[model samples]
Target: ELKAHSEFRFESNTSLQLVLKRGTAEIFGTELAIDIPYNFNGVKLAVYTYHGAALEITGETIVEYTSEETPMPIYYNLHLALEQRRMLKKSPRILLIGSGRNTASKILANYAVRMGRSPLYIDLDVTNGSTLFPGTMNAFVLDKVVNVEEGCPSSTPLSYFYGQTSISTNMRLYKKIIAKMATVLYKKLEQDEALMDAGMIIIAPKWSDSVGFEILQHIIEAYQVTVVAVLGNERLYSEIIKKNKNEGVEVLKVPKSGGVIDRDVIYRRQEMSRQINRYFYKVDNEFTPYSLILNYKDVSVKKISEEFVAPTSALPIGATRIVDDIRVVDVEPSSAMNHMILALSACEQTEDEEAIAISNVFGYMCVTEIDDAKQRMTLLVPCYGKLPKPYILVGNMKWIDHQ
Candidate 1:
């Protein structure tokens, strides 16, 4: 004699779409498919038989199965329960870092809310308090905020990926602070084995790039958790290709021109989050419109003139192309020089004396025609004095095509 039983458990309201198979004993089976409603937990499958002479429920046949449900609160609960069963367990700590904006912070916060988890949000680059606490109306709460001092000693090593400068130096310090914070937070989460088992360490940089990517690498090494990178910039995407050429870092890049808060993007994320919630107890939601905004053609350069004279004071010593409608000149590093150049470039020559005085202090100057073309001007500053490598800066005006 043999006896077999199958049991199914439904954690959420879900309908099982099934196709039944016929058995040799002439046991009839019916196929059913339906959408299980939400919040309906637990269900079972049983087998019964009816014959001409006898009606009977045969060999214990109960199948316990679980439906795929969003992992948010439920996942956290399950994780907590599982941790309690283990003698030694640790909950991982998550750190979400983004550019000094509330977009990334809010998205991550929403994910935490759905998962019944609390997260810490830090605004590393807050020029104004606007993007900080009490952010935009749509911003997410339930996460702590930490504002990094503008000028502080860095705790992490500096990255020379981009040209070295005072700003880059400060960025290194910011990275260190984040790494230290991650370590401290991880230790705290590890205190309770149950919490540890239920905890996860996550860090979502505002966007990936030379600076952001480096910061992400630092955080990954510091906490050693799974990384879900949300790329917003093409530069950042390039960095991922170069860095993780062969490594497995689970980098997710939103399609080009994809805005962070666009309706389509939000819907796509909602569906993705729902699925992730079903599979993982914790999910990270950090999307930004960096790429979309960067790719927008809304802003264009406009020309202010066809032929104009550049203020003499704005011309560099070696600049000989004076007759040319537009002349690009290199200048020495001087506050006065920069101010004068900016003024001359803007065609505000009433302050020409002051501009000249500033120009004398700086090593070079240039004067160009005042026209709509000037609006699209780009200044290329060489890395070395009179060297070939140049760093380009677009003028403050929009480009207008003369078609």
Candidate 2:
């Protein structure tokens, strides 16, 4: 038995099981079923309850405690307001921007889902993406509730490979990718009225510069964001309100949950490793990925050009040409390919730089080993037999499979 309006927070590096033995509780906004064990691994989360409840736990934890301090009521009130706005508007794009965006994003997503709304969770936090692996900007339609263990659905996500974890690597490409997503999403909303009605919940990339506000303005204009919720930042709230005063956007300042934990670079890297591992093996070893070997001639390995400029189509054929800050140039097989994550592009034509940049990733594979002399590389992919595309893009993204 526990007091109402409290939170049960824990940090676990290994496997752990949680059960709501009595009364009701929730992780984020998704309600937990009574007497069901939810397995978690390498996750730090808080199970919050508005009323008294009893929770049973099994397995090891780095830390565990109950907190009387919380901001659930404030969050709930914001949710209720947003819910009203959602009801009146055909689609209200809600963007959550702040330092503690990940936790806030999860809480808002859970709240929306419980109200029987299917919202799109857009992850711009390339440093720690929730929909796909870190370094990829993705959007997943949370049409169905996720299992507590699963956290977020990975079956299919609208993902774009930025090739780097931080937007600072290619700031120009970052803005372009956002532009492309907006274009793609507009088309999608036109076709799927349900998704339009469901709207979107976007978690912006971690930004703390003048350019950040410009990017936010660009997104607001591109996506027509109706709500901008700034968590734990009164300055940001005031700034956003001042900037978008003429735009008629609702900007709210919400308190960050006291239980939200700060994740350092080391912690983020470890989580990224786990996320990559999960991509291949899944949470419960539900999928067994196949290892495939290929010669240099088998597939085309390409990387973005170092030179950045406006797109040009006047360049010679079969040679790397600049296109919208990036150009696909063929890369020779070398030791550099080892442990690198290559995005499998949906666009088969390797010469189409524009198409490749905007096209959604079909899948991703890791280069586990490279034989320089033989010009052969080993790949660990989710594909069982044959890969659909021959165009693979390499970026700064790399992951060492601990297994």
Candidate 3:
């Protein structure tokens, strides 16, 4: 039996699974399973059981009672506002911006699905790509409530490959991709009256907020955001309010969930690698991706990096070309791309920088082996013979092979 304001904290050791026998509890702002044993790695986090409850556990485990007040019931108001807008025949475009671990987008998404609105969800946080994998900009329309345990599906109607983890790595390319997506979304909104009426929900990256108000303003203008919700930080909310005052935009301040825990860079990278593996190998199916050996000479690769343009004497001009917003540099060390996730450029050839920059990726390829002696590389792709063009773009994305 659990008392009021009590929580059961799970220890990170041998696989620990919890079955909620009788009680109301949540993890990361999402409800826990009733009877099904949930395999949990609740490290440095606690599962708060509101009021009291009984839990059944399997395997060697440790659970401590640590109670704390959480901010979840208040977030329900955002969902209510959207529902109200829907009832009033208005499509409200909602955007959630905050740092990772806070799960700003995921929480709102769960609420949106629960409220029964098939909102178009756009994920702009390419670093982790919360719903999908990293290095991709994706969107989906949700019709039913997403399961708290299963999470959302990976495949979606709208997805564009950026081939990089963070937008900060290539600001110009990031903005260009955003522009293209905005255009596509605008056209889509024009065609589907129902979807347009349902409106769009975007989850911007935390880095965007830290960048400054200009970045936030750009995202707001780009997405034509109607509602801007800031979570966790009051200073950010106040700053956003001051910046968006009288701009015909409604800004709301929301509290961060108790379950939100920040993950380190290593953990995030591991998650990204898992996403890549999942893309190639399905969880519930037997599948083997086609592997190809391609000569390094056949494809042109552009690695996006900043180079110092101004010398010490030309200090006033600036240090790097990225200061001028340059996105990529022509790299010739083709063998070094081993284990890196590369995007197959859509262009017929990689000669045109413009085409490579703005064009969509044919697909992704993970470099498994590199032979400098043979001047060739072995790549694992989703399908056979779908590499499209010879121009492949490599980014700062790297994956650890679990084989």
Best by lDDT: 2
TM-score of 1: 0.30
Candidate 2 matches the true fold with a TM-score of: 0.92
Clash counts for all predictions:
47, 0, 0
User: TM-scores, in order shown?
Assistant: 0.30, 0.92, 0.81
Summarize candidate 1's per-residue lDDT along 38-92 as a digit string, tens digits: 1211112222212111112222323433222211233234334323423243333
* Regions of candidate 2 where Cα sits further than 4 Å from its true position: 306-324
lDDT score of model 3? 0.67
Q: Between prediction 2 and prediction 3, which has the larger TM-score?
A: 2
Error of 1 at 302 (Å): 47
State model 1's lDDT: 0.29
Candidate 3 lDDT over 1-403, as tens digits, reads 5555565654454555678888777654457767877763323345656567777777675544454555545655677777688778788888887643225555566666666656787887787776667878777776654434334444444766676776666666677777777887888888887777778778776555545565566778888889988877788888877778547689888877554557788777666665677676644324588889887777677765542344566565655432444455676645667798877766675455656666666667788898988988888887878465767777777775565
Give the root-mean-square deviation of each candidate in angstroms: 21.4, 4.2, 4.2
- What does the lDDT read for residue 143 in candidate 3? 67
Q: What residue runs in model 3 are displaced by over 4 Å at the alpha carbon? A: 1-14, 20-34, 37-55, 59-68, 100-102, 144-152, 163-166, 208-210, 282-287, 307-333, 346-352
